[model samples]
Target: MNNKDMKIHLTVDVWAAQKADARAVRFDVFVIEQKIPVELEWDDMDEHCLHAVAYDAAGHAIGTGRLLPDGHIGRMAVRAAGRGKGVGAAILKALMAQARQRGDAEVVLNAQTQAEAFYGRYGFSRDGEEYYEAGIAHICMRHVFS
Candidate 1:
């Protein structure tokens, strides 16, 4: 389907997993689908971070991401069915908005090698050498804005 045919909803909440259906989407895409260890998939910092999810017109969560007070954006996930539909981009944009609302000057993320170009589209620039995280090659990226 075309992006214009898709509807994206974005929100930030303290209960990161209150949207069980949405968190399931993250689990499927990040853990089970990508073979990432469940233990590494989550961190204690979630309790303090702002979580955002993108829902489709029918209300099923299609994408998800989070923003930490220090300007870190993490746990971005898009369901397989939502891939290529601009869901990821919408979620990232929401996270950046949250950062700006909190007066952050920049947002940072460790993007998977395959997704570097995707983040680049949102103005994130590669900042360091590649490294391994959760058994996947990743690069540090940052988006600076006024």
Candidate 2:
């Protein structure tokens, strides 16, 4: 871990109280930066997923991701200040840990193609053909526990 990672704080929580921080990070990264339609950025799944939020040293939420009951991880987003700082990694780790703790066989995600390599670094491999969602190219990736 780098300096940023050392100072980053992470929490795993339900959507009820973590939605505000998680929503802010997702909105800024997906809706604003990526130009994804706000309607497509949110769904009922959020209310049922276990969320992981990463905060900077100052306690500002900078990254967020969630793990669904079925072992699917999604909605990962990191703001500009958190990019390349291990914020996304921290969030992803927390969500995957949550899934593992719940006895999930594997954790899966539809990763934007541009981020395929990032997921690969964590042992996630492509599991399907490329597809488009909200005009962004993506490929399903999965990491099965040993």
Candidate 3:
């Protein structure tokens, strides 16, 4: 269906990182779809982080991401069906807004190699060499607002 005809009502909400809705979306995208090991998927940092979750018209979580206390953004995930429909971008934008509200000087993330361009569109610039995490290629990116 065309973008307008799809009628995909997406709502992004920011909340505590450990909220069930956020965790559910991350589990589906990161662990189930990407096969990231459980050990690496769940971390203690979640409790202290700010998370954003995108929910569809049916109230089902479709995308999620988080901003850590140190200005690091991670755990970004969008369901397969949610890709290319602006859901990921929405999630990222919400997290960035949260960072700005907190007075962060900069925000950083390890972007999956293939998704670097996506982050770049949001003003994030590559900051370091490419590296591997969870067997996936990633590169450090940062967006400075101050």
- For this target, which candidate reaches the highest lDDT against the unseen true structure? 2
TM-score of each: 0.91, 0.96, 0.89
lDDT, candidate 2, 41-137, per-residue tens: 9899999999999888899999999999889999999999988888888888888888888899899999999999999999999998999999999
List pairs with backbone clashes in candidate 1: none
Q: Write the per-residue lDDT of candidate 3 for residues 25-76, one digit (tens) a residue.
A: 8888888989999789988888878777777767777888888899999999
Per-residue lDDT tens digits of candidate 1, residues 1-146?
37443676666787546457556877999888999988887777777888888888788888888888799998899887778888888788878988998899999999999999999999999998999988899999999995
lDDT over C-alpha atoms for residue 100 of model 3: 91
Instruction: Give the lowest summed-lDDT range of ten residues in model 2.
Output: 2-11
User: Candidate 1: which stretches are off by over 4 Å?
Assistant: 1-5, 16-19
TM-score of 3: 0.89
How far residue 135's Cα lies from its native spot in candidate 2, in Å, is 0.5
Clashes of each: 0, 0, 0
